[model samples]
Target: MMKSLTHRRLAELADVYGGLFHLKMGQLHMVAVSTPEMARQVLQTQDNLFSNRPATVAISYLTYDRADMAFAHYGPFWRHMRKICVTKVFSRKRAESWASVREEIDSFMKNVDARIGSSINIGEMVLGLTRDITYRAAFGSISEEGREEFLKIMQEFSKLFGEFNVVDFMPWLGWISYQGGNLHKRLDRARGSLDVFIDKIIDDHLEKKRNKKNNEGFDGLEEDMVDELMEFYDENGGTSNLGSAVGITRDNIKALIMDVMFGGTETVASAIEWAMAELMKSWDDLNKLQQELADVVGLDRKVHESDLDKLTYLKCVVKETLRLHPPIPLLLHEAATDTVVDGFKIPKRARVMINSWAIGRDKNAWDEPNVFKPSRFLEGGAPDFKGSNFEFIPFGSGRRSCPGMQLGLYALELTVANLCHCFNWTLPDGMKPYELDMNDVFGLTAPRAVPLVAIPSRRLT
Candidate 1:
């Protein structure tokens, strides 16, 4: 896996060995699924048997022993956490309630507007926007010092989490491997930094609740996620409605907060950055999208959430971007029971990776699979990233699909539309559109290998 790019290597191997191939990485038995039919078999047909997560050192440490929803094993606890997240935190009403999204976008656009006619790192700006919005939505309002510290910790944590630790494959040799790589030491440092800040956040939230200040709780008309979690803790006596057998602890709160911060920030930022990069490379598509935005949302006003649904071309651009560069290219899963997928035996405890990147580029499933063509999505009977269509699932399918899909799309589409609507972008220093580097820096989420620096001039509506 280290000799070549992980996703591409997996895809090449899948082609040779067929869509579904099994391999042994040390003591680990791994299955890589690269085609839509095989994806459906694992993600939809036998989702339950493969719903468990294979714990890694960094993820386990960061997620408070897999107490968070994303990496938790498939069982009652996972179901409970998923229920709370879906119903309380990530519900449509909850996502809409964050009026701060508009405020943050306004600030973002103003910053971009201020830099008109000059080069700006659009990727960096997009990352900042997503980070600010995620922080404000989670902790209500945080001090600058706190925000900086939290963001730094999160950035390090994300890098560490995405690293391929040798210990993950060969657990018994972990002690010897740590001496050479210090992976354990790094994980401890990142986890410790995160724990300090998150603990402070939870403590502050509890203190605010004790003081009974109405103005301090909600960001605007709605309670932030922490406030909601606190309410749940109080109402249920620190236990989830799942039962007293399993309870929400301070660790649980911190874990969920970590999930929200990491999930909300990086994935949306990556999508927007990739979308911008792709658009810069495809000027015709960019013009078409901008034209759609102009017809729907005049230049006198900024693009609003309400305007997003009507910007059909913009949606197609986003879908195309995601299809080519999914935030999470490989969906990780662990087998909970022995099962047969396409006549092959999948033993319990086997690690399963659904190669979303490969599936999206499958020549059998898509026409000109490598092309950056948003019109493919605009055609009749087009596929979407709603987890229903295996061929185009930027978000994974079945029970363990991304819970924040709606909120993520909202952020991605809104940011891209506003940027395209407000300005006509060109590569910096008179660079041609075809000269832009499209290489990706892979991690838990893949971002552009080169930061997208472009000059933006305000467009006439």
Candidate 2:
């Protein structure tokens, strides 16, 4: 958020309060950590105390008591919810079933190819790519107006998140009528729309459940996860390894959907934008990657998911992108009990925020703290970085790390590989690469300040 959103302000904050310090925005208390070791211990070794976020007024209302996985505290429910999401929602098999995702990706490249011939907005293009894939994967299809409803809600959520509310800091003042507080009002409206939409899906699934009572499930496809989980509940007398998969409520479903929709779209988009920005920032490194891609794979055949196995340098670039600009720089990990990190005591109930950005750029760990170098990742096989890695963290580590890491990687690999394979992008209107503003904005994910607008030319053009 610091580097991406308001760079100088954070730089000043870092200078004033030191890299790791706490700040309160209205009622919301945030401890922004920059050092890898400190960030790591909060998320990993001494995670119990650090993971719990100090609940704010927005969270209290918006989250339905924070029952969702993203905000919920660690306990049986957290473990159980994560398990269901990993095995049932974001399963290995579920990902494999959606050939449409690849098809949509291919469509995306075509759009990019066509747009590059003209002046295209890369930001809109990438956002569309993410939005479509996310909708399809979560729900069964993307054409419905319901899909648009979800997207609209997410966009509203992002916008509202950007504006600061004084009420969040001064809860005692409570419910201030500032524009930032309007986010809560907007959220309530979003919940109404989303609830009705999700309810319709659930009702339809319930009807399916009634019809299948004596006859097993329908379509073999079972289609949506709701149906599948419902069927499983019916079959097993209502209990999963995670506990009773039985009464997964509307709120539960919505919460999970929110986590997936928001986390799914935002982070992958961040990775794509960062990769492109970095490539533009350093042409020599960018060309080296392009050379590798060209030598092994060319533009005629799109960069397929199957091709990722051989594209080592491309993987390194993606990994390095994560290192430099991890979508969630500080993963939120809670302390389960009393713990200590780097000799600092973390009492129970302390909320931990790990700073992946500072860790990635640490002089102690990386040769150059600020420079973008993909090859550095190539030094180590596969570039593993959990909370323990201390030097790098993108998808987080330990139990609370994002389950959609693979999905994000696939989207990143396929899209970025195709972009490099197809386009010869230049700063729009011949602006020098360095002139491209790398400014970013703070939110759940860090987005470019001045959007990355590049002129795309075909290999022949």
Candidate 3:
């Protein structure tokens, strides 16, 4: 299996080679853990030794050499960054405080309404919805001039992060791959684009802050993510009172902003798209969800955030969908030290990949693993995806678990709930439920390989 280590191929290998298997790719020693027990060992039991992330050339360059939260080395700086995100940026109060999410969803519904009776690419539309929502949350407004281009460059990051580089696996022959300089050129272009775009955003935010302080008429725009991050930065030279040995700088701010943009948009979008696709292919489940929505949030109006808690079936659909189509199928980590896990030796710096995708579909962990049954989650003792349940870790576990999970889930649940409550969907071109394509394209996130094309009819009164 040295050819390619795509999640699907690795999962297939796990079926024959067992839960934990090792592979030596050139000079790099890699391990794949696919079972719940093995995954727990890597993600929970020995979490500290595996908390660090493995960076590719593209990731290092694009994220300003791991200054970002997602790939930052596990330490005081990473912890402080994550604390800022959890407490200030993605906290429960912060998530609910954003009127941007509601505004974006409303805008999305209106667009869908306009397309009623015509075929629409649900996946593409959902991606746009998520991108706009994230943009507003991070940048205070979606009116930035380079917003679309910034998003395009961010999308390019997904491909680059997952792209194969011979230098990564075999650094001894690094010169061989660089002779053509194709990957380097691409990485340079991506980083350069981000620097120009992100620098402008930071400059604008700084100017707004300065104007607000000097009694100049401030626009009174609600403080967005950039404003919050700037609280930690000192314009003079160092950090604010929240000083750190690993000082925060402009690169740090830009990297964190990139993390928010990339992490917040595509992953949530993919989950929403998968939820809708699964519902379209499973009519009974769709009916049950819509019925729940009607009982809790009547057809007279759209779903409100307040009504989300009562939409139990809607939550189940999302959980089941994640079980099958996790945004990042392969959770990447690197060994921080030499360690023995589950009676196996894990050497220092060895690359560890936990296949949450494979584990979610494992027959041993889930009953009728391949079936899309949201009802399974309604059962007592059902596992949750909140870092504790090894069987259902869509956002992953431990320190490196997605810090934006609260915000992402809020977007996923609200968008899916509104889509189902406000409209009824059907496969286009007279396509049968079984005929709809469920294949996924693996990248930084696993989105529908073929965009889900469907027709929407107004179901609300």
Candidates sorted by TM-score, descending order? Answer: 3, 1, 2
Name the top TM-score candidate.
3
Off by over 4 Å in 1: 95-97, 142-145, 177-181, 213-222, 234-246
TM-scores of all candidate predictions against the true structure: 0.94, 0.86, 0.96
Comparing 1 with 2 on lDDT, the higher-scoring candidate is 1
Ranking by lDDT: 3, 1, 2
C-alpha RMSD for every candidate: 2.5, 3.9, 2.1
Residue lDDT tens for model 2, 51-149: 455444455455566756787776666666677777877776875324546877888988877665566777778888888877776666422567777
lDDT of 3 by residue, 224-258 (tens): 88888888775442534344533467788888888
Model 1 earns a TM-score of: 0.94
Residue 342 displacement (Å), model 1: 0.7
Task: Assess candidate 1 and give its lDDT.
Answer: 0.83
How far is 405's C-alpha from truth in model 1 (Å)? 0.4
Query: Considering only N, C-alpha and C atoms within 3 Å, which residue pairs clash in candidate 3?
Result: none
